[model samples]
Target: MRILAVDDDLHMLQFVAGELRQHGYEVISAENGEQALARLEQQTVDLAIVDVMMPGIDGFELTERIHTDYDIPVILLTARHHIEDKERGFLAGSDDYLVKPFESKELLFRVKAILRRYDHPANNTLTAGSLTIDLKSYELRSPNGLSFIPLKEFELLALLASKPRHVFTRDAIIESVWGLDFQGDEQTINVHIKRLRTRLEQFAPDVKIVTVRGVGYKLEADS
Candidate 1:
């Protein structure tokens, strides 16, 4: 999963980013709320951690904008621990609040909890039509039977399946699945698509990952 860590304190931002990365999450860092907004426009992350005390576009305002514009979950990482401050954080649409001097493990747990709740995988499986992708069980099921889904393939397919029939451009796919800093080209996407097709052919024939000619790709059911 990808997380955006926004704070004006460079040291704090770096610490959060490094900590999240150590936990196997892809972390994006922004020095302030303005930078965070710009990063959001260019990258897609599962969650955001914002510090409340910022020079401008304080964490509360940033949280409101994030929830409103991106519909992404946010956790307020502020020093303020007062009851009213937390109320404002929630009212601003923060899914959770963590005061400074927090344990990294606790932050990781909260992030996972929110993502698990929001993404709401089908008991760790995602299904469309007769096809199912079981993340926990590491099995893909269809009318034909079951097959294995590799990590990148699963991430890519799941992303596309998250919004069936909605075309995803290569750039968007790269940013979403691979991180904005991934040093790969369109061939990377093509290779993953090819492999995904090979795996899908083992099970789901009616369900197709269609490339829109010059555009990108989408998942569709032959109806």
Candidate 2:
């Protein structure tokens, strides 16, 4: 998963980014709120960590803007443990709050908790270009007609479509779709990917799953 870390303090920003990166998450750093919003325009991030104090936009306004514009969950960081600040943070749409001088483990724990909540969205259907995936019915609908997809294939497609253009590592995909105890060869993923490619070609021509060489796969759609 990718996280955006925004802080005016360079040292604090670097520390947060380093800690998150050590745990296998992709980190993007921004020195201020404007930079953070610009980064959001350039790429997709699963979550954002914003400092409460900044020069221009500050964390509260930034959090609200992110909540309103991007729909990405945010964690607000404040040096003060004031109840008012915490309340404001939540009112600004922050999913969680972290006080300054916190343990890295605590930060990681909160990040994991918020992300887990976001992982399972209430919406059972997903849209990708001209295709709509009905998770409940296991149906793929396109402009042409509805197509039946195998359980595994449907799951794989849904996973990729969940985060369009975000690179999902092979290990992550295997663990998520096949479970940690899966004993099947990696070729199983390749076969399913090939089949999915053919199905997309026939049903949703505008949507394609591109291989990332040594990485796993990501779904791309024509905008």
Candidate 3:
């Protein structure tokens, strides 16, 4: 699964990301909540591991935002281990809570359990207005015509189309489309998005890939 690991401390962030990666997870790290939110913009993630004691947006607020805006699970990581803190985490919409300096195995186990519990069928398709995304056939139907897209571009379209107006950050897009293990940079995502846009223009006159300057892209249906 793809996991977004957020922490202000560089060492802690690397440690957590490294540990998660070792267990075969695609791990993406952000320095703070702001960066984390930016990451969420460009990509679709399965789960998020957030640090509670960040400078700008704390873990609780971040968790709330994630739950409110995105369809992803969140796990709060904090140094504070009080009952009240745990309550706040849950109240903020965290699916799980992990105290800092935790064992790697425990984190792995929790991630596994949560994923299994929340897992849904991968064969499902999503539709937005006249734009039909066929997951099974890897085809996208639009007003202009039907376009049989490649697997990666199809995922890119699906992510953007899932929330048409939502701005996906380049980091977020790469994580969802390319996997967190992707060693490439943002240019790779840009390239894929450009090609996806070309395909849309050719076969989807009513649907367009709208670019949000200094952010990412989204799918906008012509009004």
Candidate 4:
């Protein structure tokens, strides 16, 4: 896979690029956010490793634009271990965060983990009765037509649809959809499930998001 590494520090940029290259990834190096944006426009990249500090178009802004325009996952690199910085990175749409002075092995591990979650399915679609969940485009297709849902909601629906009728515990849902570092509670899962149920009602009457009471949720299709 191709990875874009953006950092103003020449030494750090070279280190990141070299590490990724050694692992068989095609690494693209950019000195600043502008160069990173230019590289993005030039070709398709599977993931991006962005430094949080830069002169212009800081990492947060760059990450937001990448998330909005490209829909690609990003890992934000920061020198600070402050909670505020991590929160801001996440708010800016980063998929993960890595503090500077990190070990090469840790970096590789995080990269692999994030890629695993973002990997496209072989079929790239899941079906529940009349509803078709398009994993690639994050759109739900039904008899009515294509309906675009929120990203988290779509992910929740897709997870349930992946194994219809199999109850997924709240913990599993949180880890798989929101990542293991998710700071929210079970209530967060409830909120997304609620939204998914509402959308399924309007878009796919034949499909259902079933609550398992003390357990969690499961998807069901009307026979």
What Cα-based lDDT does every candidate model obtain?
0.85, 0.91, 0.84, 0.87
Each candidate structure's count of clashing pairs: 0, 0, 8, 0
* Per-residue accuracy of model 3 over 1-223 as CA lDDT, tens digit each: 7899999989989988998899899888899999999888766677999999999898999999998888578988989979999999999999999997888889889988888876654546777667889877887887767778778888889888776667777767887788869988887787888897777667765778888898777777866
Per-model TM-score, in order, reads: 0.61, 0.64, 0.64, 0.58
CA shift of 211, model 4, Å: 45
Candidate numbers, best lDDT first, in rank order: 2, 4, 1, 3
Error of 1 at 28 (Å): 0.7
Cα RMSD of all models vs. native, in order, equals 6.4, 6.2, 5.1, 15.7
lDDT of residue 222 for candidate 3: 66
In model 1, the worst 10-residue window by lDDT is 120-129
Q: Name the lDDT of candidate 3.
A: 0.84
lDDT of 2 by residue, 1-223 (tens): 8899999999999999999999999999999999998887666678999999999999999999998876789999999989999999999999999999999999999999999999877888999999999988999999989999889999999988887777677777887799989999899999999999999999999999999898678898999
Worst lDDT 10-window in candidate 2: 163-172
Backbone clash tally for model 4?
0
Residue clash pairs of candidate 1: none
The 10 consecutive residues of candidate 3 with the worst lDDT sum are: 120-129
Q: After superposition, how far is residue 28 of candidate 4 from its true place, in Å?
A: 1.0
lDDT of 4 by residue, 23-43 (tens): 999899999999999887655
Alpha-carbon shift of residue 18 in model 4 (angstroms): 0.4
